[model samples]
Target chain A: MKKSGSAGEPRPLSLEEIAKTKGSTESETWELRLYVAGQTPRSVTAFANLKKICEEHLAGRYNIEVVDLVKHPQLAAGDQILAIPTLVRKLPQPLRKIVGDLRDTERALVGLQLRPTGTEVRE
Target chain B: MCLPNLGAESRMTKAVKNKSQEKRSLPKSLTGIQGLDEITGGGFPRGRPTLVCGSAGAGKTLLAMEFLVRGAMDYGEPGVFMAFEETAPELTQNARSLGFDLDELVKEKKIAIDFVRIERSEIDETGDYDLEGLFIRLGAAIDVIGAQRVVLDTIENLFAGLQNQGILRAELRRLFRWLKDRGVTAVITAERGEGALTRHGLEEYVSDCVILLDHRVTDQVSTRRLRVVKYRGTAHGTNEYPFLIDEDGFSVLPVTSLGLQHEVSEERISSGIPRLDTMLGGEGFYRGTTILISGTAGTGKTSMSAHFVDAACRRGERCLYFSFEESQGQLIRNMRSIGLNLDQWVKKNLLQFHSSRATFYGLEMHLAIIHKIVQEFQPKIVVLDPIGSLIQAGNKRDAHTMLIRLIDFLKQRQVTAFLTNLTSGGDALEKTDVDISSIVDSWLFVRDIELGGERNRALYVLKSRGTAHSNQLREFLLTPHGVDLLDVYVGPEGVLTGSSRLSQEEREKAADLIRQQEAERKDRELGRKREALEARISALRKEFEVEQAEAQAADGEEKKRERALAESRTAMARSRKADAADTRKVLKKR
Candidate 1:
């Protein structure tokens, strides 16, 4: 899949490549925008789950940008957010949006085309 | 640094005067209604695009115009109305009927109303163009009139006329930003979508606030409800509040104030139909209260409403009767048989009849007419006979908006109203009866029962807001004398179903018991009569036996005569057989 963000702006990196990119990273490269509206329960859950996922999955390689419409409504223009609780792959080519809470790991993994957690070494 | 202390106190005093009529603890807003700024906390988010999306005929344009006109009148702020669809003359005329006097306002340099005419087929776009022309004209108008409020009578047309999808989208984004920057409260009327709240998708992720207007009918009762779907950085009433549009202007009825807090009366007045009043409890509903009488077809819905109007006139209260089902004369003639004399009320101007067919037009057009009449007449009570008839014209929801507005208009004036609705089945005791029960405070159900080979008209109070109404269903009769409320008939088997089956069962059971008792008495009496007859038969038998014995004893002389005759014959036979004695006997016999 073609990603839109800076680290993978030209092409989506495979799990093995992502692991190598993490090894060769100079600074936090990925810029992600979790677009949400207010402190509604679903939005809050999505925000919390996204932060945890970024911390666990990308470690210090990604910079998570939380764009709350409650604070800055104008930021909804970045990735053309429509419904609330949208997770946008901003730094990846062919920007993708996954709506609803990010707690559904299987759907998120498929949407972002992330490699299975323990199978990265096999690739 | 601001330093204005001189006229501020007097301004506060004027504001206090305006505050008396407002609902308690309302946020600082104008609420976009005429004479309503004193009620809302403040005008709706100033300079931000407020989306007014509801089902059709929901008083959206009227509300927007009210905001503009009220801004010009109450606050002396100039207003500009830019309609993308209607002509300036038509828009002005529409406002005029509501006492806006747009032409006069234009002369006073207080309002600039323009209808931006755009031909969709003739327009072509080659490159991205800034809508600076519209902005420049709007800016010039604002400068000329110092306009504070602006309304775009539906932004959907702008998208319709311009073919440059990319530019239009960008321009719309720019347009909303410009309105915000200009700091003038902008109302953008958007057509509702078949699926979405707004068709153009602009209402998605609104900038500031979104108020949805819904017009709907439940069980034939139409109601228009205004609901604040989204309001950023503010708290608003989430429920859909009822509203009205008329010659004066559109007014949103704050349904939450239907408590002891508002002015009300405890005095009961007849519903013009005595039967209806008793259903409301004892005499009837209190004056200045809304009454809804609903029932299925042929249940006397119109007659009951006519009867109510007749009673109101007799009580010296002016009433306006709005019949959407039948003509005035037709209504009068039909109700005459039920004893409701509306001619006298019409003569005294106590009752004014307004009848029009429901298919005349859409719900908005009907609401507009209703608003005009209520504004002109200002009657003490208003009546909408068979509100459901309008549903045949459009969706149930559209009919509802017109209803809410009508009810709201009367309630705001403190004029009591009697609305009639025709239900599906003529069942008065339904589990959830009367569709408009939510909008109305009181509900009366009228029905007819086939009782004992005769039909009985009955009425009962389903619900009455803020009143101690009886749950008892009272018997009612309509005759040439007028509407009479009959006393409650408590029969042995409880409140009888309006059917002949109950009486038939009683009759059948009584007949059966009577026949059983008569049969048993006949059985006992016949048994005694048979014993006497048996004894008489035994005596006759004994008498017959004694007669037989006497006959036997008396048979001796008759037997001896017979034997002598036989001996003579035998002697003759012997003579015929050729003996000398026999020959003589044969000659004697010959």
Candidate 2:
């Protein structure tokens, strides 16, 4: 889903969406930020897994931003990140966090609230 | 994996090299916490991680925070606090009560706090992940302040936040090594586990130093104790020391640090009562000596302590009076009745009263408070009114040990300590519940001598070390003026006191008067007998004088009769001639 902007340039679009949403209008844009530490294997896998999930479920309404904490460690304090490869749902009310490589798709879906909890999402 | 192993190898070599270079002892980082440095033989090992493990509410976080705050404020060492349990704002607020302005310190760029919020419910683990984010945050915080000290308070929260224990444990080991590689002295706090030093056995990784803090409640009183379990490459105090957390922050009382090598002062101080002073070697208690005044209730223990404090204050010496039984107002008012204006001394700041219930805190807390106040006030004299009250706060052995430490502390400072003990009525007067009698320099026993339907107080110096003291018991009196020690009546009936002594003195006075009257009567009778004998001898001499006069008159008459007969016979001229010759011869002889 590349509706808002490219994944590499999601900050400005998300800021604009947040400012607009402060008014009475609610936006349908899904803003997701993934926190990682450098180019580790888990970070790469989590990014790949997240991209696949977003393209499959929220095809045209999602934006993915990758925050490498090694380069910008101060950004970790914003989302209270302790584990690497933490996926934070920045927008879409009730912020959620999913940690790890996101290798298990069903669990990731349940964590991000894309699928209801306790539902067995078989392939 | 290869890179991490190489890093570990390099760190191991560096540690070895460091050990070789400093073969004597590990370089230390001064915690600046009072009494902690002394117990640690300096402080925590430098550039190494020290695990401070304790149960919940045992002051682990405060201790670690103080380490950082003191490091920044006092030692000029910038520190970074990576808190896993408390937020930065919470820590700052909590430290504010201890007089540490953490926010100000942070504004000065001397301290940096990073809270690693780990909520297990919010995060779902899908696959393998390392705590690289936490490492990055901590490193960034450390680099921002160029910190020489770091604190990871309760870093074990990662276990709950992450699913893989293998990764978390490995990462923690690496983190400790990394902290060492960064050459920053670090304090890591952990929760105590069952039969283990920490809940996660974090002590296994950070092995340079491990301190165990315990908060134990005995008899409904809680005491906080700290013990240095292991300090590698250096000797440390092995005893469980009592620590206090108050407005001044954390202070560990290194009780046994004082040895018996205190300099003894030969100077003597008054016991307040002049007679009592005279009883104690004609001077008073030796300066720097511990004096125990043990007595039953109402035997004037507090009154005696008040007199001591009064005397010390009158001498212009600062006196610290710790009254465990009475409040400050009550003590002052009561001393006023004894004609001692303690309020004046208090107003002049020469006397300070620290009154509290004996059960208000554990014995250790009381000891710590005593230590703190003694250090701050620097009093020349310390008075613990009825120290036996403290025995109720702790076991007899604990109270004994605390008293020994206290006595040693006071003796080292050459502070004359006056300790009053309340002996129960049934127990022997010579026995003290705390069993601190042996170490005391002087022991004064006051007891209630019940006799002749009256209860009276008597005092005697049981023992006075290095000074000759009175062995006789004196009747203790709490008069309107002050304490008075009167000589108890020691007669055929044993030691008598109070009104009985007064009555006995009166009875002895009457007996003395009767004895004087009997002697006067006997002297009068002997004078009369001498006068009668003199009269009888004079009468006898008068009778002998009358008899001599009668004999002389009879001889004269006989001579006249003889002359008349001779004249009648007159014719005989021969008789006349013979008489004339005889008369002439007799006249010549006369």
Candidate 3:
């Protein structure tokens, strides 16, 4: 039912990784790097928030590599990062991105068109 | 798709990119309409639940039924109808008049109609459980009949029954996964929210595809519409569409409705009227062609159709005649005078006439009856005597769709169809009765002409799909012998018009009177000259007669004088005087 492009080389990497990874990988795995500014209260909160959420939501299926923008400004431009806190869900389908501290799960769910309720996630 | 740093500038770009992405993977489906499937690239994704949310009475149920019935009947895919509202008996009865024998379909095991009665008080969700119970039933039925379609009448019922949004939304999410995993195309109906796609805001929940049906009253004219709100992963039509629900069930008409999908025949077949056929081309209307005859009232449209049926009957091809204006007996008897005896055809089982009053019923009923006959008779040629009468059954657009379905249905069977419409005006209106001209392969326009001081009936081939036709308007006359296309009435007046013919007759009478006066004058002059010459000759004869009489008297006197002179001369020499008198008398006689 998911009519993935009948034409076109099945793009194995995200657009950024495709540009950076070049020949280093052949696994066809989506590697995502969520960039943040400094380990300020906002950046710490965003990292802790994304770690637990990814484990509970995506469940060990994805890898969320957090990058600190204050440490490496060059990496900010590499991923085209402008905000301090951003969560990028790069995956098997359309790679989606959400910026800011992941406080509102409703917004994140809508952005991804993900079913909001897990068997235990419902309040 | 490019994204700048998440600045305000990038934020604006993200919105644009979001719209563009939404446009890319649009979810499209057949809607099962003729030109529409091509537009949507072959229907919605199967088994992926499509949300059909609309305002009140927007034809959501009608559309869902149409899709399911079309699949079951046309596509041979049995369907399952799960209605949270409306009982099985009610749905059957509601659609029964539309010729949808849901009851019969259920009996045939071709379709399963289930009423999911949800009682809120009964919901003792003391234990954590998904609505997998309902899903299991639907799945079982689909597996039982190999049903390909699943319709949930109103999705709002779920929210209405379950007060806990957390539990309800969770089950809603699970339902999509369950249906998609099962791989059966599903259409779930929902009531529209005040402004959002659905009242429960479920547009984002189960929307692998989304279709919105709307009923709008613009300028006091209500138009029911259907729109593919959003369908992911398919290229779909984005325009709001108008649909109709009549007896034939729900029929959706695509925005750009006309396209040549089937191969049209270049070969023309006989319309049974030799005159009309010859004018159309050497042959006649093709066996499976749709012919439209349109004109004003009393223009022999019915008679022409009757002639065609009579001809078909003679040739041993069955014909179905549907008359919206007159009774069957009236049609038969009226046509009898014009040499079309339907009674004979009836006996032969070659002609069937169905006559009904359009105003006596509804549009859906008319379509149902038409569809029913098309299914039953299986005639070689079908004639809708005057489609104009059926326009009264519904608004103009409904009539168009019904006629389209009818035409498509007939053409599939290769049955030639003839429809007549009484166009509104005499001024050569730029528009037709209902754009019936679009669906028909051939258009026959019969018009009344005013020329030569006489009213004449003329028939012409406005358009014949693929043949060399005579564009000349032939004099069409209805008589006891049948309809005839008279030869060209060539004259200085050119083709004789109604008033021109009458005027020519009037002018000819005046010319005859003038010629008569000129001939009488010539005869009188010849007689007068002859009489004058005879009178002059008579006068001259009288003069000659008088002269002759005097000459005779002088001769008599001279002879007497000569005798006396002879007697005197004999007596003596004194006869010299008598000799001189005699000589004088001789000179007078000479």
| Candidate 1's DockQ | 0.01
Q: What is the TM-score of each candidate against the true structure?
A: 0.49, 0.86, 0.52
In candidate 1, what are the lDDT values of residues A23-111, reduced to their tens digit?
54435366677766666777778778777767766777787777766566444433434345667665543355565577666556545
lDDT of 1 by residue, B391-424 (tens): 7656675566456555655666777888887767
> In candidate 1 chain B, where is summed lDDT lowest over 10 consecutive residues?
B1-10
How high is the TM-score of chain A in each model? Answer: 0.67, 0.74, 0.61
Chain B only, TM-score of each candidate: 0.55, 0.91, 0.60
Question: lDDT of each prediction vs. the true structure?
Answer: 0.66, 0.85, 0.67
- Best-to-worst order by lDDT is 2, 3, 1
Candidate with the greatest lDDT versus the true structure: 2
Error of 2 at B477 (Å): 2.3
Q: What is the C-alpha local distance difference test score of candidate 1? A: 0.66
| Candidate 2 Cα errors over 4 Å, as ranges | A1-34, A40-64, A89-94, A109-123, B1-23, B560-571, B574-590
lDDT tens readout by residue for model 2, B433-485: 88888888899988889988989999999999988888888999889999999
Please state the Cα-based DockQ of model 2 relative to the true two-chain complex: 0.42
Q: What class would a CAPRI assessor give candidate 2's docking?
A: acceptable
Order the candidates by TM-score, highest first — what do you get? 2, 3, 1
